[model samples]
Target chain A: MRSFDGVYEGFRAPVSSQKRSLPDSHNPAVNMASVRYISKVVKALLTFDNLIWYSSVKYVLRRCEEMKSGGAKALLSFVRVLVNIGWYAYLIVAVVTIIGIPHLLFRDYLPADKPMPWMEHQPGYTITFSDAVSAEGLASFARYGLVLGLPNLLIMLFILHNLRRLLAAGIENPFTLENARRMRIIGFLLLAGVAAEIGVNLITARFVINNVHIPGATIRANPLPYRGGLFSALLMLIVSEVFKLGVLLQEEHDLTV
Target chain B: MTIAVHLDRLLVERKMSLTELSERVGITIANLSILKTGKARAIRFSTLEAICRELDCQPGDLLEYVEDGEQPS
Candidate 1:
């Protein structure tokens, strides 16, 4: 937390006798690696399973930080590459799912002529829409996709943008006003996205129950009516405020020192 | 807001430059400027001790409390 760690080292030692045993937070490679690590942590915040894979990795990083190991940067570099690649892979998967869902959902791949064996006891006849304007199913799918996908997309972009700023500050200057503002933005965005999703889910369920007519039998709509994930967003907002206070205190400390 | 620093007066009296005081006290010149310019939010005991030791003065000699209704210092 103290950038003052080695300041006294240089002061106390004779210029020629000074050994360069310090955190290389200034190196471009190391800064970028830290950025990557922070980005990975941000991405991991959304997921529990992904964290399982990184549990050992995180512990190792913490130990390295504790030991002040200069060589740990090499390890951080490797982990940075892994986290960067994995995040891209994850992003690609989400994008593909967003694009592919409608393609698969609306296709006449299942013949509308008669219900396939899976439709047995299920009330809907397979209806294919030539155009989305006339078909309720197409409308529902498109609405659901936009409602669900857009918020998630926005939240991801916003968080990544904020995390980039935070990480670019590196370990020394993490408590900048810019980073605090970004964190606050991220917190608000997460809250808004989650709120919008829960609201849309209820609306979507209702739409399905009412508009998705399958020729008459009991058609049940599984409308997941519960809202969730507010606690995490609330916690993030609190953290953002703390960061703001940190920025203020950091300014005072800077002036003091 | 009412507290004022007389670091310049002390430095003048001691015939010591801010940079020399900073070097002797093991603090940066920028921080010394903060104290001299009265922009510091607070001062630490160690820093005060160092400054006091360097200047051969008491804390009260370098610091003054002006009441809010007092004329501009």
Candidate 2:
């Protein structure tokens, strides 16, 4: 009886008083109530698998409420920092990619022992050669870095710059026309990136891949942009349109007296 | 845009300034100015009711349909 007190304590009156009224645990109603409460508790515990899950859910909801109140600002600021860091890292990689061009030009004049910093293998292709790979084949590796890398770097820089500005503006007012414009521009840039990727792949396959040969080698390459990029670009465009609608709604809300 | 807000005219007829109307309607002066200038995209029913109650005018009296090429007075 005293142990059952902990189970139904919150829902019912204190254990001593309730037991005094009950007279005996054999009372059918009392027995049923105790069984029902015990079953409910057991069910909840079983549903959660363990006590950790119950406490974890409670903690997460409390944290979520805290974030809803004011933690979102901290999260946004953290995201801004991460975006900037990513842009800086990408710039460094772009610089490395560009370095391959000069190395390709004056590779003999430079140290021959050093490995090429360029992207020698593209994403979609595998090549096998019986004889020695030609100089043209090696040069095409460096050319691959330039053709695809430069456009990608430029597009990413624009996208990141717009995103940085959009976040800064969004902190003040997320549904502003400027934010909508930034979203639209970002969407367009993503589409442009897809176009550039496909174009570069096609041009490379036509001009560079043709020259890149070995005596009895089979070169298999797909001159097509990845579907993921295309999907993302289209998704971004849809998001941009939704952001425009949000901006319009925000304007109407602001004007409402 | 063809539906012109006659809030300024209503305020003028009532001999009430925008600030006075804004205070009477319990709405912000800036929001009243937006409504007055006909720059508001849509008016909420609650806001329109508040404005109408203060101005002692019907919603129709405060808003009028103007022909596309005709200038609102």
Candidate 3:
């Protein structure tokens, strides 16, 4: 039973005796100081780690000092030029759509048997006021949607394309304060355009519908909403004013930045 | 329209090889070859500095003016 166990036990006693013979000076102050030092070291390490993590996140989200060395400003200016081009193009489309409205509305007033001067031939058939009003309402809806949606969509696409190109070029300039402000202004303009259209439709719907009725013919106004051309034009003016204000605000912000 | 670089001549006079010079100057052999053959559009001041430092010569020593119909100067 006491084969090699007694010898191993004898060797363990010397190591335990040595440990026990060490000075047992248990000072609470010294222990607390050691604990405080360890805690301070841990806190410093944690702070350094946090700093690195935050800087890395900022580098990914926004263009840090290093990645802004390329032609970021030039690219943004080019994007602005593209936006202006798109705005002018949409303006041209809106003007053309507006010019066509009169012709579309007055097609029935032209001589039926004889071809009108502008018409290539008689408009296939005579269109009543009720039919004309319904068609005008649909056309107005289409034009309003186009005028409100196309320019903004084009600008957004341009921004997205440039953003992708910048990312591909390894240049990170996203989330800049200027860019965020510009985006907010664009959103405001789009929302204002929509609101203006809704307001005009609400106010002028009954007037345009009532005025288009045939005398003594007892034709009911097409139950559909209608906004007069002049009122729509006025709304467009208001939207344009909002757009101009937004542009001015954005430019002022850019200058200040 | 054409600017000739006399790097090859300088390298030969200094008893240096293209590979050795490229390695000492920290530039690719291909770029050094292009510089020597006068096919490069532009060279940076830093690269020029490194090359001059490694070759123990000035930039003018590595570049020479050759008139259109005249011999190299």
Q: lDDT for each of the candidates?
A: 0.68, 0.73, 0.56
lDDT (C-alpha) at residue A254 in model 1: 83
lDDT of 1 by residue, A92-182 (tens): 8667777877665554332223222322232335522233223334334554565476666656666665655555455657788788787
Across residues B1-73, which tens digit of lDDT does each residue of candidate 2 receive?
7999998788889999999887877888888888888888778898989888988889999999999999977
Q: On a 0 to 1 DockQ scale, where is model 2?
A: 0.50
Please state the CAPRI-style docking class of candidate 1: acceptable
Off by over 4 Å in 3: A1-148, A172-257, B1-3, B13-15, B40-60
Every candidate's chain B TM-score: 0.92, 0.90, 0.88
| Residue A50 error, candidate 3, Å | 25
Candidate 2 global lDDT: 0.73
CAPRI docking class of candidate 2: medium
Extract clashing residue pairs from model 3. none
Best by lDDT: 2
User: Can you give the lDDT of residue A34 in candidate 3?
Assistant: 78
Pairs in clash, predicted candidate 2: none
Least accurate 10 contiguous residues by lDDT in model 1 chain A: A110-119
TM-score of 3: 0.31
